[model samples]
Target: MARNAGKRTSTKLVFLLSCAGLLGAALIADFLWASSSSHSHAYASIASNWVLEKSGTVVVPNKEKAEAVKSKNNSVDARILSGTFADLPGPELKWEKMAPAPVPRLDGSAVQIKNLLYVFAGYGTIDYVHSHVDIYNFSDNKWVGKLDMPKEMAHSHLGMVTDGRYVYVVSGQYGPQCRGPTSRTFVLDTETKQWQRMPPLPVPRYAPATQLWKGRLHVMGGSKEDRHEPALDHWSIAVEDGKALEKEWRTEIPIPRGGPHRACIVADDRLMVIGGQEGDFMPKPGSPIFKCSRRHEVVYSDVYMLDDEMKWKTLPPMPKPNSHIEFAWILVNNSILISGGTTEKNPITKKMILVGEVLRFDLNTMKWSVYGRMPYRIKTTLAGFWDGWLYFTSGQRDRGPENPQPRKVVGEMWRTKIHL
Candidate 1:
């Protein structure tokens, strides 16, 4: 009986030790697995490895889509693009109207900092151009005044982009109203509300499309001195140590074809420029009116795409030959939302054709389609994307007889939502 008890005790001890060893190994394996999983997940989140991950999608809300998702309350939201259109009545996209700017100004540049939009330098009322800066709060829905610009620039185009703080104003035309093609660059610090002069462009170009990409700002395809003469000159400015220096100015790829002096967005490292008047807007005799034939008008629907190698590839053209002063916003993956501008003749006409057509371009698919028009017609307007919608303010209709000096501005505000 003693021998049997000893054997049983030894057998129990062996089993317990075996079980403990197994448990220890399992715990260690689990610990290693957890550590490896954490590392893999973190890397996957930041690396943008589409192959190792599923493709994400965006659905813009429209009449059809909005109704489809109405039951599922959290899935869709309806919004509107307001203001005016040549043919459309009322607001196009059911948008919330905001407070107008203190004074209406056209061709003014806007940059968003800290979720706030800042407007600066353009043609103001009284037929006199001033360097005024207006700050608008989206959350509060009001326009507040800031300090004046350091120099007065009249009849100028502001090529603007922001690093989320400092707004970089690139090569634009500015001078006296009559002789306003001076090559100038300015930088504004949104935090301090300060403006400083930066290095000027090699040549004077107005309404040039400027964009920031690959740590450099590219200024390309603008008018040299006259509106009729377009510059194929492409220049890149490097921002270093918080100043625009001349040594940093290097020429890159010239535009394949001369485009109007309007900047479009650089989406997916691809740069595009939209419409501007191809022929010169020469002053007519006996009248202050400018006349030009549309025969020489090289209306561009061809959207050019610039690659990292600085080579140009023509994407599908814009849906229409509409190019007053259009702006582009990144709607979603491989798609851009473009809106506003004029669809009139190059020199314009007694009856201005204000374009409210909002179109979307799919970069991946190379297709173009119309969305909706603004409630009102706007030309020479400054537009940028903020939050989740398209925000455009401070524009002017076609040159009216009341304001023949070309400084009439608009006070209305509009927004467009892309349901995706």
Candidate 2:
């Protein structure tokens, strides 16, 4: 049990402030906010993995194994999502709908410590964001409990990473959309479930790349306080047991391109960063309403790797431009798999485009491949690998395949076995 468990820093003022300003949402932002969805889907069952035949057509062992499961009841059952080329022997992917999250989340962060998956604070709406943390038991396949963050904790776009026992959450936007970023950082002890304030970031950032590497907590690129400029500064702090050993952060090699909403991972002793965007919907300088510029969104497929010499190097770009994929990655057989996110936008309309392909990046071969596709496109999803199954939950689902637009933020928990 935690030492001081029931105590909470009151966030009522800010929450109300956000709601009070809700009607002041920018035109682009108002257009982006999606209403709830009641869409239902039918899924099939998978027999075996996929194999690419000599004719270059991907085929699965069993194709006609269809299973009828109703998602209306939020049943925790398995469903199959196969390839679109029904005539051809397309790849078959298996997925399960576990219990939905306690609340809809986006722009938040999640970390897995053993079997317990901890979901942090995030936006439930442009005017509303949750300040509590939800815990999901992987073995039990349900939400077991919830914990409230410190009153000072940021509400969304949080940069988070876990060192197995202690999860570090760095700077992020503390209020509603375009309110501003924070320099405050916190760490949660999984054993005690106690969140203790850590050293504040030298500069505040929005959805920065956070990772634990070689006895140090490395914090890198995100956006600045204004939400328009990128924070290219890279800083690290020496620490042990979730406490900073040094007084302040030490300057490190900055990333070539600075941006937020990037996936940061430290695998096999090397640091890697994948798909992210540079600039995004920013509030006009003097407008009381955070008037957004939908046309300014510039999503990218940039991938960067930190070499052993403490120098930054470039890697092969992704198959297409992707962003908003934070926490949507899982490691499988030495390859990094990114599930769903936003891809390129429409050239003429400038509307945000969603992604459905499961991108697999071979760390050994330094190559990228499309493992399969998700039944629907999503962004800001959380991912975890347990019992040999790839589980991801909580994201904004796309409207539909024919008109794949960003829909409402959902609590749907979906899991699939990696066919690769």
Candidate 3:
């Protein structure tokens, strides 16, 4: 555990606020910025630190001494500090095991609303891909069944977002092969507990990054054909007649960095795209050879921001190179918390391991500062904003024989607080 400047404390563990209520700040009314770098930049109040669970404790590390606490041994899983950024070690932040999912789920999306964690649409091993929806009550600590997807989708990139009413399930994969992608959108109205298909996107894309601003759902770059193909265009969808209607998907704004199948989130009214494979990764829509680039299938850590006016600008890159859909970003107290996601290679086994590292970016500063790593390396872990804490779901370890083989998924959950 590390200490900070403004507040110095000797307490081993503490809970400052509920996870959901911690980052309660006035949303930036507009995207404003001065000429500092290449594009428009805005300044906002930022919380000082981000807290995470390591071994069994909660730890809060600030900008001053961030590099010291990036390991599992020092990680804490302190249960009391579910979402508070306090000074504890990795041991204090690890959470206790809760009820297991009805069945093991992979490639599903989870979102929390009204104290319930809803997980939907994922595939499983042994020849089963499900659209089965499950709900976990954080308060009561119980798992309950919800509605299931009308269709079965596997390897589909699930994008979950909220407009205070329904949870939107955007484009994903389907079919026995689980290879073809679909642009059809689905809405899960928590109020009515009904699922309805929305308008299909102009182009079918899966694994597209999603965000909501001003009640509009923004779908960023995704694989146009499949997970292997990337699309740089962005689309906007709005609710009309109780269904999502595609207003228009404009490729007008050049991305701060282009290449599709990226991950994104909304914070300070700016759509930030994180790590994704870049280059001509997408096949020519109707071609068979699929596609490979003269450029290596390299990973990226660059972060880009898209404004309301569809302007693109680059932000500071992540401290390390990362690819894959294992990363998560959430806004808490004017700060963006990034968790999980692996580096380019594994350190010990020399094979890739699911990463459990955490990083926090202050929206105001536009700089990335290391938060802390998890006790175990987590790859393919689900990161979501619940209550106020950042929830990191199951991921795997890399003890395999290949450069990226022997991957295993963990069935545990961890939470941390943003101390901004």
Worst 10 residues of 3 by lDDT: 44-53
Task: Estimate every model's Cα lDDT from 0 to 1.
Answer: 0.59, 0.75, 0.54
Candidates ranked, most accurate by TM-score first: 2, 1, 3
Q: How much lDDT does candidate 2 score?
A: 0.75
After TM-score superposition, the amount by which residue 319's alpha carbon in candidate 3 deviates from its true location, in angstroms, is 0.9
Q: Distance from true position, residue 362, model 1, in Å?
A: 2.5
Q: Give per-residue CA lDDT, model 2, range 1-420, as digits (tens).
A: 353442322366667778768766765465555321112111001101011101111111122332223234433222342222111122457777889998988776889888888888887866677899999998988899988899998988898989899989999988765677899999888888898988899988999999999999999998887786777899999879988898899999989888888889888899998988877656657768564333255788899999689988889998888888879898778999987888765432234556777788998999988887776778888888888778888877665554445657888888887655
TM-score leader: 2
Give the Cα-based TM-score of candidate 2 against the true structure: 0.77
- TM-score, predicted candidate 3 vs. hidden true structure: 0.66
Candidate 3: where is the Cα deviation over 4 Å?
1-95, 152-155, 175-178, 240-242, 245-254, 258-262, 279-296, 325-327, 346-353, 385-388, 400-406, 416-420
lDDT of 1 by residue, 115-223 (tens): 5777776666423555777787777667766767766433456567777777777666554232446677777777677777777778777667777777787787766
Stretches > 4 Å off in candidate 2: 1-90, 285-295
Better of 1 and 3 by TM-score: 1
Model 1's TM-score against the true structure: 0.68
